[model samples]
Target: MSKQVMLAASAVAVLMSCTVNAATEIQWWHAMGGSLGDKVNEIAEGYNATQDQFVVKPVFKGSYPETMTGAIAAFRAKQQPHIVQVYEVGTATMMSADKAIYPVHQLMNDSKEKFDPTAFLPSVTGYYTANSGEMLSMPFNSSTPVLYYNKSMFEKAGLSDADAPKTWNDLELVATKLLASGAQCGFTTGYQSWVQLENFAARHNVAFASNDNGFGGLDTELLVNNKAFVDHISKLEQWSKTGAFKYGGRASDAASLFYSGECAMYMNSSASYAGIKENMPNTEFGVSELPYWPSVIEQPQNSIIGGASLWVLQGHPKQDYEGVAEFFSYLSSAKVQADWHQFTGYLPITQDAFELTESQNFYQENPGTRIAIEQMTAVTPTKNSKGLRLGNFVQIRDVVDEELEQVWSGKQSAQQALDAVTARSNELLKNFERVNSKS
Candidate 1:
């Protein structure tokens, strides 16, 4: 080979190395595992393929609570990732960390990214929006709870599959039939506090906490001991005694009961659709709106969301913000959003995405996938239905779960358990406020 040709080859190799080194790196720490984790990696790979200027890397960091805690610790050490995924319950904590976050609205405006807040669905975005009407985080996998019933079990019990329980009264009646039909249990639920208490209050148009469920200010207190809650819990306690209702444990543990065909009806997050489909390939199940008590309210109110969002962290360079904003723009496109909604059974964050999914006839082919979207948008959200915002809510939910377990075990009455939960949770809230107020 000629010396000139060798020099040209050396120069080309050097240029290629420089191009690779020039791309900025963005770190994303999240709690997505299993198949969801695969999708997260796929998204990052797709974005990286679209451009050589930036590379977004996704790192799984255990569960939601663990991931948020890790991010907080990292931020204090000045080693924080560029982005983090925080569940809805942690909203109050994140908002209080004013200096630790780069609000999505501000980030987009500063980065000159094309963003329209109105393009997102109001129901999904309302949870992450500030009182000033600015969006705080990018809505990722928003979901709401719904009723999932085994159609085969319903038929065996001589109940019509189309007539899944619409009201609490109907649920009791159906539970009785299901139990009598040789089912191990009538129904079970995951996230007892979320589905049976928090959502129960929203669906009944009753407040779960004072100050508009803590959206107004930090001086909020729990109001879950209200008559609606008391009566509902008391009824569940009675049902438990008769084996009509079974305590399936906490946080999707009861999902096993449904999967094993022990429980005829299961109440869980809409995001569980993918798991259910994958686990029970031959089982015939249908999704329905969460049951409400007609006697409590003439009509049920809209349900709140359950899932997490993508929050941009502070301490990253200005160039990183630009890349993050551009990645977000790509994530929010109709095609991307629609694909995510269809795959994960999470509600599409934007109206355009929902419409795009509809245009593809995804719902027509998969019944019950749209039930959660319909249930969330059925009625305009009032203060009670907007969603909860309480400091230390992750711990507050644990308190609620503990107290509720007491009621299930007959160690405490419904009123006693809820009253205890309120008292304990309020003390945690007070501490959170006292510390954050100073900051």
Candidate 2:
């Protein structure tokens, strides 16, 4: 070989090195902790390994509220990450920051990546889309509440593992048996306001707000104190007295109780699968859809998404935006999405990923992983059931928790507590509407 060839070879090696090592670094903020956090790292690692041009650095900032606060602080300080993992309740808050986000559809289009609004689960995508069907955020760990039962506890109480309660009536009957058989608490729940009221309203085919549950407009009202909500809370209050149900603290505090086997059944996010599997492997656990109020409209309706999505924060350099698009495209790949769903029990955001999982029999073998998907697909989600998009929803959830706590503690009747919540919540909603309109 000639000396020229040797020099050319050296030059090529240097060029390749420059491209790979010069990979754009994109920062991401999330709220996941414990085993769920591990699953997130695995996917980011995979994406980083398969690419030479981009790196996604996921940062665990804290719980959902804390993470949202951190993101806002970063943005205010002009140090915001390119992507932020915001919980579903923070949707309106994120949207209210008009210049702070890059609406995922726009970002994908600008970067020339293939994107389709119709291809995602309506129950997941609908919450993040604009009026024109353009998605504002990339659907990430979307989840719905499901009943997690300790199969060992259930069977010990003479309950069938295959038969999960479908209605509140069935839940009460089984819960009574579990308690009678010596279970400390027959049932408990995490995110009480989340599963019991927000998603509960959806499953009952009841409107959580006017204007298609806040999708059609910013002027939405609170309806959690409606007949459906009253009846459900009344029952829970009654059960609380017998110690058949344990009232966990705010923001999914019941996770500890359920994972510790303190309760026979827990209604929590289907996303909790990884944690249950990790900490309670020796315990026989079962996952099923959250029970609906049979007193409400009969039959089942769709459950809305609970987990956060990747919102592209705007106000960045053109190069940064380009890098953001590339990284997002990487996340949207069938391989990454499939593995993410398999690892985390999150609903597959893309149709291709869902099909891939089914073809591979990922769900057939995994008992509880399919429960979230089944709940999501049970109905062709209507506008009313698609999900909430109201402004200041984060604050509203707090109000729900506060009022419901009163009921749970026997300080107030369910009707009184719920009615008070409704009146107070509407004021907050109106305030949000007023401010958002001006903005």
Candidate 3:
């Protein structure tokens, strides 16, 4: 009895091991944390359950910059993951290191996956595409900035939650009322550079950088001190002095401020919707289009994306590439993308996915959830509004953040701070251009 039982159990164990060994494992290094990280793992689990040939292994590698840096170190050591999630700010850096990446379009084509760039939203994909119209990476979790306000705070200020401020003048009036009503802060924002500078310029149809925001050529220079941009910064400085605007830390630190009811209004990535809902279960909030300046002739131009994308790294096995292509195909499906967009509040990248979400009446039921998607594609993206592709943008953003803080702290004027930011960032860009030229 013991011998037969042992033999049968060993046979089953051997079969299980063989099945595990039969599937190709693809490593995906990502920066998603919290609820978003759960969603990433869920998608991987679903893909694994759907197929016997391939399994996607999603690894959380800290923040965006850290993940990209980790991947570079790994790539040099020939131990990189098959896929890496890179934030929009790192696009130029990734593009410059083309030799280290497997261009996603070529990867899909070589693996015989059906890929149609035209099927994706132009504004969403244009940021990651090459001059030849080749998509270098898969558009994943793409998001745009939107205004989030507390419904209760609006009510407390004798304002209607249903009527959100649409223009900067309207916002100024609202912020005054909010402060008068004893709110801790009238408004706050996350990703100061992205929301206040980059998207701010794009939404005003102004240039944040030269050379079409750096897409036209690598010889781009910073224009953060432009009149339109400086005006916005100056307004923020005034609001900060008035106790109407608070400076939360960079990169979504302000999200918690809104969620915790300290800040009455917030401007942040559309992807923050899920986190807001999850973390502030008791708070009643509303989402709306980002406010515009009424004095600007180009009042309502579109906003650019903020989240990250998946880039395929080089030096992976052929089978791994094939698996990566298959996983990408799964991700690109209408249903999957729609589900992701709905779950995460990121804009649906593909037209089909957006249509699917609409057909389901998700936006109608949710209310205000579609504003980010609308804002991202509201108008044709002019050269100035397409997106920023400045090299060393990650470092540039840090400079902007540091300089802007000086303005917030009242140590420097808005013009002085922005002028300093532009000068320092251009130096970094020049260094980037020179280094890349040699490589």
The model with the greatest lDDT is 1
Model 3, residue 95: distance off in Å is 0.7
Candidate that beats the other on TM-score, 2 or 3, i.e. the better one:
3
The 10-residue segment of model 3 with minimum total lDDT is 14-23
Q: Rank the candidates by lDDT, best first.
A: 1, 3, 2
Estimated TM-score for each candidate: 0.95, 0.90, 0.93
lDDT of each: 0.92, 0.84, 0.89
Clash numbers, per candidate: 0, 0, 0
Candidate 1 per-residue lDDT, tens place, 105-203, comes to 999999999999999988889889887789999989899999999999999999986679999899999999998999889888899999999999889
**How does candidate 2 fare on TM-score?**
0.90
In model 2, what are the clashing residue pairs, if there are any? Answer: none
The sequence of per-residue lDDT tens digits that candidate 2 reaches over residues 59-172 is 999998899989999999999988999988899889877888888888889887766667777778988887677789988988888999999889878989666788888888
Question: Per-residue lDDT for 223-339 in model 3, tens only?
Answer: 888788889899999999887899989888877788878889999988888788888788788998999997874458899997899999988778789999989988988998999
- Worst 10 contiguous positions by lDDT, candidate 2: 113-122
CA deviation > 4 Å runs, candidate 2? 1-22, 34-42, 48-51
Of 1 and 2, the candidate ahead on TM-score is 1
Residue 244 local lDDT, model 2: 77
Backbone clashes in model 1, listed as residue pairs: none
